[model samples]
Target: MSLTSNKSSSVLSYLESVSTSDLISDPASIGLTIRELLRRFGGASETTSLTLQDLELAFGKSIALGFSLWQHMAALDRLSAIPDWLANNAPRVANLRNGSAICGLATTHLSSPVTIHGSPSPNGYVVSGTARWVSGFNFFDNLILGFETSDAYCFALIPFPQPIIPIGSSPDSIRCDFRLLDLTALQSTSTGELTLENFPVLNTQLLSRREKNARPAPRKSSLKIPELGVAKSVSKKINSALAAKQTHPLSTDFASALAQINSRITQLEAERCDDSLDLAGPCHLLIQDTLRLFALLSGSRSLAAGSEASRLTLEAMLFDVFLQSENSMRLKIEAAAR
Candidate 1:
């Protein structure tokens, strides 16, 4: 179902009921909020542009929660590509839908030099290497990991907490360790470094396997939704501040910039184009500009820890690194240099 105006307002109201500080201090609270949302709004399959627009609305309320929800929904989207797996895992899918189980994506290795190699085994494959960044550590019950083998790139769903090995399996069959990273922002996400040594992935858990050099699937514009949400949130705050002090020297300039950025975001959303490369740099640049404007408007108050301005500034910095691709990185550099 589409996330109608009433549903978006409902989500915002529910988020408003909890203080941001309290939500950040307790990651489980974010999980509960997601569960409540799933129970009310339905599952990832139901996530449309309106659903994402609701998340964009969420960014103004809580960045951490918005980011976490995006991660969950993205994971669901990836899983949907593997129809055979979904057909066989009905109960697991139900748990995911109902929020009885939470899943995180660990596919940054696909773009990074860090390699999680999978060696073929009788059961499936043994994966060993470090997955550089995995959010939702303590809160996730499963992880969808991407790894490289000799001939292909593979995706697999592995149980978190390291499931027990089957009888007759070697003692070192499955070993996984999680090290929580101390992040400057989004600490509530519990992002961490995941180390896997001789971790076995059963055949049933295997999702998609593609040739290492195979052409990637068409890009989706939905990927930009979260970033747009963040940009919109920053713009709204700046506009609110400008409204309060209409005579401020930079008010008109900032207003114009916000209008242009909002117009661009709306245009992109309406097009729903499959060209992320063309969108990434402009989106990042707009967000960066709005963040700086907000900081300027807040003055010294934005520098203070736990301040909303400070929180958003740091969160925007974190997004700069989130799912960075070589092309996106180059585009951002080009945009910044302009």
Candidate 2:
């Protein structure tokens, strides 16, 4: 059966009850949340006898993470892959299934794309690359990194503090430590820089690689739940502030816009479950509008430090550069020019 509004609301309500302190830590609360969430929907794996409907509900549960950005982003690394990634890689699934986080380090800034390379070796391959701004992933012991081989790009599942075996003096390889960066936003996420130098990814560890001369999948950074959360929470705050002035045209207009955005989200989600439709593109615009509305209507409260409005203001800017698409960035640049 499809998840109803009541069931979805129940899951969101559970997220609201979970405190920030409970969600971000070693053995992250997000994992616990996912584990608990799985109970209601069979589980998040294909091996577990989960029906197609059950699997859909399990994926839907992640939308609740939007309520807590800390949990949402931290959990995104592992949750986004779910049963498919997990079921395919059974060898590592034992550790991963036990609340472990598997971070994907594919996001790259226009100026600094993934510079890592993997070359063929007698045994498997030798990987050396630099993946930047890898947040939330550091908390876990496992990481799924992408590197460009001589012919194509490939993904490898590597354990943290990876070891290098001596092979007739291949030069003693040194694995580096993760350094948490103090970003303007998502500072709470423990965002860090990952520098991998001559790291070894055994053939057993290599997950999937892009085929030589094959077309790459379209890149669409879909982050609907968090955007929806921002809209829902910020709008509620605005609604409350204007409770006495409900009939005011501005308040009415804000309410109308929020409804329209919500309706759009539902329609789009019903269309597909994946990030293929440039979901972030539309959601980003709606979120930007909500942020502007909050700033304009919330008045002095928006300026206060540590306030939701202030935090969201930074977050609004975060989505653009945070795993944003080239097309979206180009559109933003064009809009600025106009």
Candidate 3:
């Protein structure tokens, strides 16, 4: 659906107060529509035998669409120009859409404590503390917060507020900042620190419970597995479509390369599931295969600048960069080995 004539006005009207029902109810549809829209704007999807890729591509697509829509609004001179801070954060968000190959993997297993200290007597999680480099925080309605309680990490789903304190904006004692160096292309989605003094958290606002040193929930894991299928379908379709349009002799090579990568990745996945091979190694292999596909699809054209095709290639490049982090690779490896 098209936004209102006064897009900025409409967006504000749309988001002024979000009910949990409005925000969480249609996450799946919202994400899909976003993926299609971004695909129109030169984004591609890839899959690994991992769930975070699905979550990233899906949710990340919506956020990217929202941001793109915002840019359109700004271009129409409907919304005021984005502030410098917001502009600075756009690269991070865009990369998030491309990095669907590894979204949510970073924070899925942990929870943080938020101390809220404002308004009606502990009515909600009065978050005086800040979340650093929160991707799409401006649009996220609820955040799964974690805190240490009785020597355990307890997680709760809390509503996120606007006017967020972005990482690298400025340093503050009560603010949480994401570490930027850890992220590759998603410059904005870094994992930062949160600091709060006497922040109040209420019982009702809590989202989930993380028992100290407890393994991740199996239900969540199972749910994520299916989501990866969506990305796999999308990537396979795009690569095959690109393969079919080939007029050059080299096009077959590209097809062969993509097919080879996909074949190897699938074999690795099978081994991972059968407990015959370590997941850590396969996860690394997945990243490598994804990068290889990106290279094949973009070819020498990926190096050019100032053209529409170049922009598309750049998005994929940034995506691979974001996925290539050593720490992230390590986590996937560890999770797989487990």
Candidate 4:
């Protein structure tokens, strides 16, 4: 099926309104996709264990990279509990789902060890540090900053649209400055370089884990549905474009790629409920290959600096990032990259 057929008018309208220039400044377009998916997913709960099929249905229903971010966080909400010792008492921290906060873990620029120091204070810990690789901040209401401290991976939830903390003594509010950077893709995501100077984090905002640091007897990897969903949408668009130009020799390759994506989606749908970890690997490989073929079949047309195809090519390269650190799936992404 052509990507056009898979999308509704509203989705198309939103996509059409964005140009390369628009993406260059902000990619908040993804918020629309996220909002639609949340509504369709019926607002996930701590118990909602979403599979690839659910993501496919949601992606096929709408579209976005935020979908994976939302899905992963939702899954974390469902699967992992904020350790009682490290848990914050803020009501908003527990309600992060309502704002669809962007997880800043492993973001590219911050991929180089990043940490926010916690200065002990009477009210809470005053965290002050700069963090980059932040996306969807313009739309997402909070920043899920994951940092490497002394021993373990520490994560925190900071409310968005934060007020600036004064330079000298502790002030009434914490402030963050944004220096948006230009990127190859997902520019519309509103990604930026964040500078935090004495940003206050209440104890209730700290996200703690209660893991014993041991291997599981039955380990299995879960799929990053949002990544796959973005890949799915891009693949359909490539399919539609290829279908329109049947006379092109690359059409055959396009057909083959589309078939492979479909096959992978079908397999994921059937096997996701099982305990085996084999499903996400092949699915990512398929999406990776699908993006490559999209660039190939689209050829010179895709070379345009701000084209959607170009953005997707960059997104495909970044597919491996932003996932949980201990996740075994990252290894597969590494292998696929190789």
- List pairs with backbone clashes in candidate 1: none
- The positional error of residue 11 in candidate 4, measured at the CA in angstroms, is 9.2
lDDT value for candidate 3? 0.38
List, residue by residue over 218-330, the lDDT tens digit for candidate 1. Answer: 64544555667777777777778889989888878778877887787687666556553366556666677778878888889999988888888777766577745566688
lDDT of 3 at 70: 25
Task: Give lDDT: candidate 1, residue 248.
Answer: 82
Task: Give lDDT: candidate 3, residue 104.
Answer: 25
| Predictions in order: lDDT | 0.74, 0.54, 0.38, 0.53
Over 111-216, each residue of candidate 3 has an lDDT whose tens digit, in order, gives: 3433322322345433444343244323333344545554345444344432335545443323434332343322233223444433455766444455667875
Encode model 2's per-residue lDDT on 38-134: one tens digit a residue: 4543233434322223222322222223322333333344334545666575654533333333333333221335577777877678876566666
Provide the global lDDT of candidate 1 against the true structure: 0.74
Query: Ranking under TM-score, best-scoring first?
Result: 1, 2, 4, 3
Question: What residue runs in model 3 are displaced by over 4 Å at the alpha carbon?
Answer: 1-107, 111-133, 161-195, 208-220, 223-252, 268-284, 287-294, 306-338
Candidate 4 — what's its lDDT? 0.53
Per-model TM values vs. the true structure: 0.87, 0.72, 0.46, 0.63
Weakest 10 consecutive residues, lDDT, candidate 2?
58-67
